[model samples]
Target: MVGRGTILGVLGVLMAACGTPQRQDSGSESVEGRVIRPAGLAFPYVKRPACPGEGCAYGTWLACDTVSVYAREADTTERAFYLAREEPFQVLAGAVHVTRPEVVVVTRPTHQIGFQESGVLFQQGDTLFVLDYIAEGFFDAWYRDSIIETEIFWPWEHWYPAKDYEYGGDVVQQGVASFWIQVRNGSGQEGWVPADRASLASANSLDPDPPRCPARAE
Candidate 1:
């Protein structure tokens, strides 16, 4: 009969030969062993809505398991989402391979102001113009409402239409100086109003830069 110690020793050897339990591939393409980040590669994480069934929306602030990794390359950055398990390395590796042939990354700074800095305050029945100097045209306008309003304007558009404008926000980015102001109408919808149409609530309120209009013919 085998001694207890001998039997236990044999069992230990058998377990070692079997090796660590193989990780079940969660149907996702992943490596079986340790994953290492490539040299000189940097990835940044961004927050987004989690999977619908994961119950992340109602849970902790950062309870979402879905992580978006932006892998930066020489000229371009590739974006990928990974389902984080115990580790994110394996998922990252897979993302990097798929997004090869790096794409260039372009970034810009956004400037935001508060209510105090909003160009002017206007009331209902005022008409405001959406000016575009480059196009030399007034594309759209807003009919002011009664409620206090805010606006968010983009700097790039030569002409930004009021219909496309965002309302009820305190952020105003560097955009063309067309006298974009915030106003509300009877429907309670607020938007950017042109300074030319609406009179400022106070001279002390923020003022818009002079309109960059085309020069008059001699």
Candidate 2:
């Protein structure tokens, strides 16, 4: 039998429950993260995902799912920087693993199923929050939304876009986006990494070990 707690994307559940996306305030650091990716290769930070050719300030290499940030000024020089392999960096801006209570809400009513849901509920303090969600019934994909506002974009003109970026699902498929986290090391050097390249370190994690997520409201 399907569990009653089945959960799933951006909706009222997102606004109603998880009000306002978590973000680092101007000049105020919030969540902490680390970059240890590109795997065997040392992590690469680009001046901008704008590598038009080997002529770019950082030289041609800004391809794949890379992340970027708005330079306080428009200085495009010094585009790329390679960090020490497997070093810890601070997430200037990124998602934090938060602990909160979750509940299921039916968003769409169907003939076969009682309802369809796009998000799950969670609580912070006395307020509620929601995380985007999906199931395998009518939708093959989950998480629908735009990253244009979040500075996460895919298919930089410099590099080849992902072959499967189109992704399936008409209504169910969220708009395409590539996520990269803005990070800074101890030397105050800041760079961007594809979401996959970074890892959350305990030194500055928002949540403690064995995250105590809030319980579902009965």
Candidate 3:
């Protein structure tokens, strides 16, 4: 018979080796000779509706928050956008864009620990956009509630308090994809755009030389 201690030890080792379980769709891939995994941000404590019918004991529930992570080719500066599974790094280059290339700064948020530290910067005409770096990860939080109610006893009614806080939100899986960029257009309007929509600026020049239009054949 296997001992309880032995089983726990083995489980601990397995968890340590696996680190965090990644999403099923997110498999490991190789990029520039380095192994990359899918990763994303995870939000916890989102309110959700409870199940319907008499079987449903809990009133309301919480939902899980899942986000995708993406990456792009490294630029001339050897900087690239990656997930926050590991340590933070700097990305010196931005992706190519239709408009003039602009210098963008990528930095990890100080609040996000144990995650990547890279972001993208875009400059379109006089408008500049910044995408603050956030690590791709998730966590599970448990919440509970206690209720007081009247119970039927032998020839009498009794008051009792019940506890029912054993519900766990949702499982968080690890994955990677491009982060979203916050855009502030020339008109001062702000919006969120996916990282893939615009390429990072390779050069810092506000008005880089534009690609010449092709000449039509006579």
Question: Which 10 consecutive residues of model 1 have the lowest summed lDDT?
Answer: 92-101
Clash counts for the predictions, in order: 7, 18, 20
- What tens digits encode model 2's per-residue C-alpha lDDT throughout 113-193? 212434322221111111222212221111122111111111112223467653111111111222234557567777655
On TM-score, the candidate that comes out on top is: 2
Model 3, residue 193: distance off in Å is 1.1
Cα lDDT tens digits, model 3, 144-218, are 111111111101011122454221111222112232233332333333323332122111112234212223349
lDDT of each: 0.21, 0.25, 0.20
Candidate 3: count of backbone clashes, pairs at least 3 residues apart or interchain? 20
How far in Å is the alpha carbon of 31 misplaced in model 3?
A: 25
Ranking according to TM-score, highest score first: 2, 3, 1
Off by over 4 Å in 2: 1-79, 95-175, 197-218
> Which candidate do you rate higher for TM-score, 2 or 3?
2
lDDT of 3: 0.20
TM-score, candidate 3, is: 0.18
